[model samples]
Target: MAYTAPLLNKPAEGWKHDLPGPNQPPTRTPNTRLLPNPPNYVDDIYLELPRSTLAIRSVGIWAAVIFFLTSTVAPVLLIDFTVTEGHLPPFVLNFFGLVLLSTFLWIGVYLWRMDTEAPRDEPIRFNRLRRKVYVYRFFHDGAKPFSRTAWGVRPVAYDWDDLHAEACSLYGPMGTGGFIETVTLAVLKPGTHEVIDRFLFTHEIHRGEMYWAMAQLFMQQGPHALPTFPYVPRDWNNEDVSFNLARRLAPKVVWPAEMDLESRTAP
Candidate 1:
């Protein structure tokens, strides 16, 4: 079955414990280490963090790989078929070409859509005043590359108390060396283990605890309690050269009017 975002699975069973509240220390050491991507806004009201990982250079690399495979591998396969069969049927060659083209096209479209058309940053807003967390999720058809479903940012809000951090691991095909780790912030039903909604908190498993701690400190003790920010925050709205040139071609960050208002101010 195809996996979708906002996963609604029960909490993984284990010796589960409640996460520490504001003013309490996080399990992992906390530091203000926002590099590469920094918060657009961090104040007493809210901490807005950017979440897009792909850059424009990655797109170019993928395009090069696709070109190399099509130019070298396809011709080699054609020659092999001709030599082995003595005479290649037109329909056979056409069918093979069609299949190859379709496969490549699907992959190319998926990559392009993610790089250019998707939101520049899907930010998560932690409004401490309201004790609510707002997530700007990038929605897509996870299983189908050729799916025509609209791909865009979907904003949602939940009570801060309902969120729990879960560490998840995805192993590579046949249990190979390619391992992916992530921390999901799951929203559970009050007093129950059922997870109603989830948000990706961090891609780096090693630093996930630290990030959670930072959020806790900011929400509980305010910006005064946090450590000195290691690097200068990027001005995403204006001239920030840290981003790749292709990022300029992507859509700008714009939260919905109602959600934007609610997330920035206390009721």
Candidate 2:
């Protein structure tokens, strides 16, 4: 399916909010939902989550199952014919065996299939000390990737300020229905705003929290910080009610309407 990038407007021209009360001490610290020391590594994590794999893939899992099961029909028919006919030749039986072997082998190929969901130690590591992002892969669960010859993906270290973090939706095949949202953290060339490398990529539902956490990281530690959440807003953003604790947990940082505070500003 076709999709355009979520338009990110840098602090809109002539738009601003009343500076958050300094005495108010931010109401509360920004809570970034992160998986603490998942399985193996110990670094300040920016974002981490399970992505769909062959075993867990909604499409691939079904596809492999469907393809593998369909192959069984041919062998089953051949076996039935040989048993029922009684006078079947030896070559016919051999061919049946071959078909059965091939079917079993095909299914075996996907048995170990899994997505990039690695353990805590072999996870996507973002070191605050080194200013780098490292994606570690492993064949064995408990081993550290430093000495072992494990698969490490292209993880770029950025200056942080140049990293553009956003929550964007990826449209599938257009005909397949809705979009899948992802947490995209990439480095952009200054001025022209060309994307360098999408250093961090996570496809999941909690993209807002990830995006906010990432933004908070860069803003406070990397280059700048903004007290806002990335968009488009979720199911929680529509409510205008004043009573619910869920809504009141955090101040509305996603006000597309309130951002334009020109009229509300002191004239």
Counting clashing residue pairs in each candidate, in order, gives 0, 10
Best by lDDT: 1
Q: Candidate 1 lDDT (Cα, whole model)?
A: 0.67
* Predicted candidate 1 versus true structure: per-residue lDDT over 49-160, tens digit per residue: 7665442334643573575466455556777888888977478776777677667666666666666656667778889999899988877653575566667677889888
The lDDT for every candidate, in the order shown, is 0.67, 0.38
Worst 10 residues of 2 by lDDT: 15-24
Q: What tens-digit string does per-residue lDDT give for candidate 2 at 206-246?
A: 53333335434442453234223332222322455364332
What TM-score does model 2 achieve against the real structure?
Answer: 0.40
How far out, in Å, is residue 209 in model 1?
1.7
